[model samples]
Target: MSRETIVLDHLGGHEAAARLIGGRLEDVLIDGAAPRVGTIYRAIADRPVKGQGGMFLRTPDGPAFLRQVRGLAPGQALLVQVTGQAEPGKALPVTQKLLFKSRYAIVTPGAPGLNISRAIRDDDRRDVLMQIARSEMDGGDLGLILRSSCAEGDDDAIAEDIRAMVDLAAAVVADAAGDAEVLTQGDGPHQMAWREWTAPADVITEAGGFEAEGVLDQIALLGVAHVPLSGGASMYVEPTRALIAVDVNTGGDTSPAAGHKANIAAARELPRQLRLRGLGGQITLDLAPMAKKDRRQFEDALRAAFRQDTGETALVGWTPLGHYELQRKRDRAPLEVPQ
Candidate 1:
């Protein structure tokens, strides 16, 4: 039986949360200096970039870049939410299509409708959730989506979540006419852990929980690129200014299928490695010398592994030089160790 645990603690003076599956660290979330994703800002439209369809907006934190600026004019005030973290010296990424997300529900302001998660295939359960949504929404102009977490959730709790999100959306929309300012701050690490990590797990909230739960030791390994795989195979994940490079090696494995085995192992482990280190953007994988016939199997394993990942990733297939490429969203900030 596998035991899962969640440790809430402080790291380098920042709030942090770690998820451990069967005593192995699986995921980590730490508060970052950059504005968190989901932060709502009433911003003033600034100058538009030539040739690019993006426009700059002035916010309380800094300048934010928003795409899909079709009829947006300069000096017009609009509500935008932080979509992702920006690179150093780059404008913050914001989107006009704001979504208010919670554990059980997501309220979309501009889009108006009520929908349940496709994962909830049970007709009875879907009907129950839809009835709850309809009752709370009351044909409002905003949209409501019941998340997968609500499939087996309690009725009253789900109703409260829906109501809270709907109220928040209405209030924020009403505040859209204000000057450039922050209307709502995003959830911190602890709050996010409670909101998203709904899986059954042992919770640790006391001080020094990270050290007690061995999360600190696991986090230390993130600073190094070496990741060991079964049968003496290994992979090195190195991040560069342009892309993240993953190099797979079959160490001391002299079998005929050594390359294939090592590549498969690397595929299974890549998503967890990237998630823990909070690394994203372009990723290029240099696998071992495997035969062309094995590419399909490797891709299948990679796809299956990433299916459980929360980050948005696009596998761009193999390059002419035999390297595989992927583009990942920068949803989480890069892990920074305290000096």
Candidate 2:
């Protein structure tokens, strides 16, 4: 049976968390110096970039870019939330549509309604959650979405979580009239682990847990490009200023189907590798020398693997040179190697 473990610790003086599945690091979060996603800011509209259909805003952290600026004018202050990490030398990406998310609930301020997560298919459970939502929300103007984590959760705890989120949303909305400043910072690594890693796992909260759980060792491997695969196949993930490049190689495999096997393995492992390294933006895959007929199979494997990923990714199809391309959101900051 597979066992999952969560290690809450620090890396190079920054708070960090890691999820270990059967002694293998699956996910990691580290506090970064950049402005984190989900941070709300009361920002002043700076200038408009009409060609890009977005306006830049002067924020406390730095300049932010917001799209769909229909009526926004310069010098006007408005609330915006950080949606994703900014690329190097780029303005932080901000969105007017803010969502306050927690493990059990997500509060949507402008969109009013109550809804249960679609993953909960049981009619009975849905009814129960709806009752709880109605009681807590009381026909509030804000929207409420009960996350999938509420499917088998304790009623009292879920209700409490809903109330807390509702209160937080209300407080933030009430404080939105302030000058250009940070309204609320994003969750830190420990809080992120609590809010995201909801699966059943052994919690290791004491110090040095990462080292004890072998998370540090696993993270050390992330600094390198090589990743081993089954049957001596391997792939190298290298990030450049323009894009992330993945190259697959069939090492010491003389079989006729070696290329196909290595390519498929690379496809399946690519998502995890990219996620662990916190690499995003344009990704180009130089797959092994597989037949054109096998492209569909390789794509299928890649799609299936990425379906379970948390980051937003779009497979942009094959390039003219038989290479595959993808566009992924920069959801997490690049990992900093420990000194």
Candidate 3:
């Protein structure tokens, strides 16, 4: 058999490819078993982003990240380099729109479908974004942020990015033979705040105030802390129509309840905690019942406290068991409190 062969990004007639090049190419998936690093826009020689987000080097494998040049005009989609497990290759096509991106990022040849676009002005942040794009060549599942990382970036920063990609691509090409399996990670702040919000609830944040990194990581999961209880020395109560027992040894509040004043202060804090924790659904607060006037004072306290509650709450009088019984609405599901 005899035929003509050419690496074509576009073919007018019948085209079967051993190689695809240039800006427009057919999209292809990385080998299912390869390790995928998420869309990189930053440089990281260390750990993954700091968040409660889940990342995996899955089998369906991720797409690619291509570095763009200044003179070139790109199509909606383009050819991408392959950071293959068995070999390093180039010019495979992947979606330029970059959809289904729960975490991974795919940088295109021209204007990428990422948040970091071509018009970035900041030099340092630009360098960071470009470095990150280079790192996404592998098939890792990482939560990434591409929006405006390149916005207002300077030329030097852009140039620094080009250099970073070239170096990274060269290294991948170099190591293709000796090491087939490698993990590539991108840069992150103390944590990836935007990434963690997408995780399932299981991770618990206890105690009070965290470090900068801790706060960032938690922000991704817990979010802006709209309501916080800082629950300590607290007891979970099983509320019944007969009585409500919220054994308040302390809700992690170590304030000495030595006198009536102190106990009242501590008791007053319960409604705040309920609101902060978002606790509701027929709650029976088994607080220490006080004197005859303290009863009215406590009811007054509860009524005042209920004002902060986002959920619906109706306070009944204190029970004979010296417990305060109340009915509070559950906005979502009730939190898992240890009884």
**Would you give me the overall lDDT of model 2?**
0.91
Error of 2 at 288 (Å): 0.3
Model 1 ranges off by over 4 Å: none
lDDT, candidate 1, residue 19? 92
lDDT ranking of the models: 1, 2, 3
lDDT of 3 by residue, 1-339 (tens): 112111211112211111112211111111122332232221111112235221112111333333322222222212223221222242212112222122223223333333454445777776776565555433232223343433433445544444454445444333423211322332221122222122222222232222211332322322222222224343443433343345544344444432234335545566645543334555665453245556666667667766754356777666677767677653322222222
Candidate 1 vs candidate 2: the TM-score winner is 1
Q: How well does model 3 score by local distance difference test? A: 0.36
Per-residue lDDT over 1-339 for candidate 1, one digit per residue giving the tens place of the 0 to 100 score:
339999999999899999999999999999978999989999999999988998999999999999878999999999999988898899999998889999999999989999998989999999889889888997757999899999889999999998899899999999878689999998899989988898888999999999998999889988899999999999999999999999999999988899999999999999999999999999999999999999999999999999999889999999999999999999899998554
Best by TM-score: 1
Clash count, candidate 2: 0
C-alpha positional error of residue 261 in candidate 3 after TM-score superposition, expressed in Å: 3.5
Model 2 stretches with alpha carbons more than 4 Å out: none
User: Would you list the C-alpha lDDT of every candidate in the order shown?
Assistant: 0.93, 0.91, 0.36
Q: Cα miss at 336, model 3 (Å)? A: 5.9
